[model samples]
Target: MSTTTMKYAVTDSLMMLRRSMLHIARYPSMTLPLIIGPIVFLFLFVYVFGGTLGAGLDGSSGGRADYVNYVTPGILLLTVAGAATATAVSVATDMTQGIVARFRTMSIFRPSLLTGHVLGSVIQTLLSVAVVLGVAVAIGFRPNANPAEWLAAVGILTMLIFAITWVAVIMGLVSDTVETASNLPMLLMLLPFFGSGFVPTDSMPGWLAAIAENQPFTPVMETLRGLLMGTEMGNSPWIAMAWCAGITAAAFAGSVALLNREPGR
Candidate 1:
């Protein structure tokens, strides 16, 4: 990274940031689901099935409170997934429109361009998390932990978003079209269904339970839940960080390799 290269990277990143913000400004409707979807999920699960599921898991007859605490982490993860979709779709659109190619033609730092998009996505993810948390509070989902625990919860969620954004970037670069990028987010959204998001893994069938307990999302959600509820994370925090780091490295390496492989001028 020569000074010139570093400068280019920073400049390119800033350009990408400006472009992303402009797109958001131009289309405010897309922001609606950032608040709506998570709220809906919170209401549907916490009110409808929270009683039965909570009772079965917590040994209480109707444990809506426990259910609320358990699912809050899952909902936050889902919000990050939703934000990642936008990142992927926007990157794919830029690639398809030849914008990336044009940038490549210039002396712009290629890595910076991707980094900028990832950074923008991370910012958006943070905003979405804040919105979800606010909604969670409104719906009686209070964190039992002190300020330190709350800070840790934020750190964990930030790490999760950082990792997921790279995955989204890879999808954007590899997908043949923007529509495909649009669909990639659903994969992240579905992880919770198979894990301990809505229910306890112990109660699941043996084989399925094993998989669910060990899945990345399970640990991530458990880590967040533990931090928020001021309870034992039971090995989830470390496992979640490992998963996030591994995925992020793989995705970043793959995306960079692909981008650098293009024919030279």
Candidate 2:
């Protein structure tokens, strides 16, 4: 793109970012669920079910001494789940209110509007992930990996959040109503249950194991667990990266295609 266009993109993106932050500031209650849902899930899994599950899995080996550590990654994923949904709702609300259409009629760069929303969501996801990490630490969860590995784990989670946000963006762009947009996030949240989030694939039935082993979330969880627990991820890192890339590509292409389609086409 030309320098003028690049400048427009940056400026428009910043404007969008500021507007989103303003919305958050004006209505602080919107952030409550982002904080609460992860904490609730962490407590339920770590305290209520942790002991029995850890004992059954580890037995005398003490292989899984800290059940909190086992579920921390899942909790981080949950944090992203909450943030992603909120982002979808915001974007959809803007679309339905003619905010996006109004902007499109202006001289502003169009893609930057979407970029700003996605960037804001990324920021929110990072903050939520940090809070979840803190909660995990307070509950006695410890990372077995070095600083580099921990960074890698965070990077993986960030990428997953980014990929998922695109899916949310697509929903926001296409949904006819704000209520419909809100449903997209809940649908995305269901992905973890089918993967290695709450339970290990080995503990599941054969058919379920097969599904979990191949699902995108399983590899992402495995990669995070490997980094946190210093265990072999069994090739999950590569699979996870592939899944992220695939989703990112598909979602971006779909969003662009939908945006470009004529209103009645």
lDDT of each: 0.83, 0.81
Q: Tell me the deviation in Å of residue 12 in model 1.
A: 2.5
Model 1 residue 5 lDDT score: 78
Q: Candidate 1: where are CA atoms >4 Å away?
A: 59-61, 263-265
> Where is model 1 poorest over a 10-residue stretch in terms of lDDT?
57-66
Supply candidate 2's per-residue lDDT for 36.
84
Per-residue lDDT over 1-265 for candidate 1, one digit per residue giving the tens place of the 0 to 100 score: 7998778778888987887777776876666676678779989998998887778766445578777877888888888878878889888988888888888888767787788788878887898789888888887787888889888888888888989999999889887899999998888888887888888788899999998887788998888878887666878899999998998899899889877876441
TM-score of model 2 vs. true structure: 0.93
What are the root-mean-square deviations of the candidates from the true structure over C-alphas?
2.0, 1.9
Candidate 2, residue 209: lDDT = 90
lDDT of 2 by residue, 1-265 (tens): 9998898889989998888888886877777788889899888887788887666554334223467777778778878877877888888898789787777678888777777888888887788788878978887888878989988988898889889888888998888898998887897677677777877778889998998888778899889989988767888999999999899889888876776566546
> How many clashes in each candidate?
0, 0
TM-score of 1: 0.93
Q: TM-score of every model?
A: 0.93, 0.93
